[model samples]
Target: MRKLQFIILLQFSILLFAQENEMKWQEKQYPDSLEAVNKAPENHIILFENENLRLLKIFVAAQKSEPIHSHRWPAVMWVYQPSDYEQVFYTENEKAERIPVQTVAMKKNELPMNVGFPVGKGDLGLSKNLGNQDLVAYRLDFKKKIDSSKKITKPTGWTWNEDLDGVKKAPASHQIVFEDEYTRILHVVLSKGEEESVHTHQNPCLFWVVKSQPIEYSEFKMDKKGKLRKSKTHQLPPLPTDQLLDQNKISDPEPPHSVKNLGTENFEAYRIEFKK
Candidate 1:
């Protein structure tokens, strides 16, 4: 039994070392400067970037193709604006891996949020929008290395400036699509005029503003019985703040609060909380 356990432990350690090396190679081969935004400057735009993650958007007009480029890191891309369309990506360096144009469908006003995608070492090449409408999609890249043994002490309930965790108290809106030892990523959504129940985020977070719309944020105090006391409120800019990455802001631990969508369209954001 001890021998088996030792072998398993050794294998896990080897796996970690291999992952670390692969990530380093991936970055070197496809440095940020050569990535989609710079490689095809007109189409792929950088939305924001920090040590933890980077967010960007791709805009391809009807029947147009962005230059052959590469995105170093894998991404969890969301359903696009005017979501229904056809797109063909020619990949594999010489563009030998020709991808069949597939119809990406979505219902009216549907926010097609998804995870674990934009794969294959840069979609491998250039993208061509085979539709009439202008195509727009947000792509988020996780930059931090995924650790296998990090954790957060799971909270049980709410307390003043204490518990009241975001995911625990408000799971519907702050939907966690992916989580690992290093990070917890939530696909947060709020319909127009919808307001979330008060909750608190204990960790500092990096945000990818997927939907650009206005919002009203309010912070409050909770008594022992959970009744709300006097609070303060503020108005946040329409998300994605601007075409400029610096316009979008991140979050640090704050008091118990609620966020309400104050726009005509649904509000969407990728909230990446760092566990380290």
Candidate 2:
């Protein structure tokens, strides 16, 4: 009887340990931003956390001369640098190999097992669980335990909508490149030699760059009585402030301004402006 009791206790202990391990294995969705990116010497990683601090989105960034490493978790990474390279390894087996990442823009691919993703200048590639970069990433954690039956989805990543008043064009068609979602997201794309007249928005806002380019910007702030206004612009200011590499914040009473695409290629930007 004593031996049987001891065996029963051991089984209970094992069951408890297994339950704990299962609880730690959770999945979630993450926001898109630079803060979500985890940077390391070997590579760059991004983590998306839910409202409860749950890991959601994962990204990886790698430079030349990097090795093919294991991706313990599943993720999607967008490559920004390097033009040509390779991911050399076996998908079902463990071996070192090279895999080319050079392809058309807007290409999405999933990598299985350990593989090398070659990158090039102005090339963007997406992959999962790869690299050892200690980079910060946008994260979303769940406060309460989630159900496996529940379906998870990601946000629009970035989108644009008209203002509350249904105004598509700002004060001036030339001044406002594009305006939408007075409270949420606004996207603007400018081609080379495109310029807008001076104007302001209904609320405070922030500008984010979706694509790359050499561009210029200018802002004119109007004072009370509409007489005292100042004009200023900067050349691709630091990210999030000038160009959003990650997250952004816009306060109420949105400011007004005009922008122009000074680069040879077209400019793509997103703005999150607060509504009254």
Candidate 3:
């Protein structure tokens, strides 16, 4: 009898813990506003939005915090200027927990680089910048539900391809930073006056300007004999310090183009290519 009683007590305790955890998750509510960029324009700016994707540029000043906001869609964050930060999650019981999120460091052109992580839909609480430098990043929010059938089966690998165009052929500066079944992320850095080889983009993509600057754009065509023929040339207006340029099937028809750095500083960006 005593053994059975103890077993019942243990089960009750387990159930209570489970319920408490569930309540914590429930307390983190999703905001009704579907567009974060519109709702929180101070920190979140919508660079482009469509049926499939919503690209947002996020900036937070040093020693500041953003108000409570929720993300309803799964998104990938590309951190351009990472600093010390904390994400607070609240519970219905008025209890709060802090999660310390940090960016992973990688090497680009033998220089240290940092990148953000993928986030799921939930109440993300306040984002507090603890570091002295301002935080700048881009978030690629998917508007549609994730399709499980199209998920990547094999492990993603990083590679540096020289034949890629619209950027310099430096293997160290251009690399595949991240990849999954649904998306591929490419990191490119071009020095001043450096030209990217003529290349074509075949997939719908989000171009994130990490370190924004002026650029010269030129379109060209390849003959049947694999010779390049210049068609049009224009100067692309300087983008904001941190912005995202969305290109869809209608806008990007896989035409060959090249880009040259017209600014004095280095041009850096991340191109997120979507499989869908």
lDDT of each: 0.62, 0.36, 0.62
Query: Over the full model, what C-alpha lDDT does candidate 3 score relative to the true structure?
Result: 0.62
TM-score of 1: 0.64
TM-score ranking, best first? 3, 1, 2
Model 3, residue 156: displacement in angstroms?
30
* Residue-wise C-alpha lDDT for candidate 2, range 40-145, written one tens digit per residue: 2234422223343222223234333333333233222222222323333212112322244222221123211111111111112233333333221221222344
Which is superior by TM-score, 1 or 3?
Answer: 3
Clash list (residue pairs), candidate 3: 152-181, 165-197, 166-196, 166-197, 167-196
- What TM-score number comes out for model 2? 0.34
* 85: Cα error in model 1, Å: 6.0
lDDT of 3 by residue, 147-200 (tens): 867732222331213354323344445676556777767787889889876776
- How close is each model in CA RMSD to the real structure? 9.5, 17.3, 11.7
Worst 10 residues of 3 by lDDT: 103-112
**What lDDT, from 0 to 1, does candidate 1 have?**
0.62
Find the 10 residues in a row with the least total lDDT in model 1.
100-109
